[model samples]
Target: MRAILLIDDHAMFREGLVLALTQAAPDFTVHAVSNGSEAIAELEAHSGISVVMMDYYLPDVGGSALLRRLRQARPGIHILVLSASEDPDDVHAALSAGAQGFIHKSASSKTLLEALHGVIEGKQIVPDTYAAIDTNGRRLPQSDDAALLSALTPRQIEVLRLVCDGLRNSEISARLGTSEKTVKAHMTAILAGLGVINRTQAVLIARRAGLFGKPN
Candidate 1:
């Protein structure tokens, strides 16, 4: 069984997630805490926890700082940020601070499960829509720079578009009727062709290049 810890300031939200996670995976051992301090205590008390799901806003500490502290304390445990904000900077900050993934609170239950599983498997996860938002939460305007777009194959463009639509690799695979490995291959090519290091950056570049029809 997998041991998971959830940290959020709101009792209602934390309870709701507990129920949702229990329904999604019955074998998961979940512990919930309402603040960063309590979360640290919970971590100290539970040595078997494999993952920590945290909200970006906490009453006692900022999410990113707390994440950094947790990473320093327990480098092996995977930490995932669950935030309601769709700001690209927030996503970038959390991941840069050592979070394994950033999950929108609005994600469907199935998507949430997939994200947790992906993180447990040592994968970095970010919502596809992060590409559409600038640091100030404004949609990036389309650019006339077709140089990057022209370099990509049609199939890679297709994958990139779906990535902008906020689909995970597994979801993209189902949509394209391909295996996840094939989707990963396409992503690798897309990253190299775009000259970006990660999917989020690739999507942002594609959006700026007007590769996608409209910004979400």
Candidate 2:
């Protein structure tokens, strides 16, 4: 069984995640800690941990600094940040400091599990939304807009254009003569292709790419 080290400050939330993870993945043994010190201690005590899933905001230390220390302690260990922070700087900092993956706390359990598996397999997983921005929270340069626009299918482009027009999933479904579920799937694909996290980001990127006109 693969060992996982889970570090978060909240006792209740940590316990809840422990229970959820235990039930969801029986093949993994989870070691839980409430702060960065205990996390370091746990890491020193156990050499079998395959992944470290940590919260971004902790009372003991900043996320990026702690990530560096953890990486120093266990070189090449898979580290995944599970935080509620959607800030581009936080995402960039954690990854630059050696985190292999970052998952928003709002993600479903299934998405979390997939991220865990991806990290374990050495994939660098981050939300397209966060990945598309720089550390300063600015969108990436306009030069890549052409490439990004070219990556989408014509149908996905239509869905994205409708999205830029401020259409909801149901509205887009109605406009495209497709089900809401299908529109959601296309939106998901568009987000992944565009390296964005939400409809707003998608619209911004599309506008920058000249795939859609700017709002009045």
Residue-wise C-alpha lDDT for candidate 2, range 11-82, written one tens digit per residue: 888899999899999999999999999999999999998689999899997598888888778765888899
Candidate 1 structure lDDT:
0.78
Stretches of candidate 2 above 4 Å error? 141-216
lDDT of 1 by residue, 1-216 (tens): 899999998899899999999988999999999889988888888889879999999999767889877766666678888999977778977865667688899888898898888777656677767655555566654454468879889999899877654456876898899999999999999888876667666655764565553222
The candidate that achieves the highest TM-score relative to the unseen native structure: 2
Q: lDDT (CA) for every model shown?
A: 0.78, 0.78
lDDT of 2 at 125: 69
Clash tally, candidates in order: 0, 4
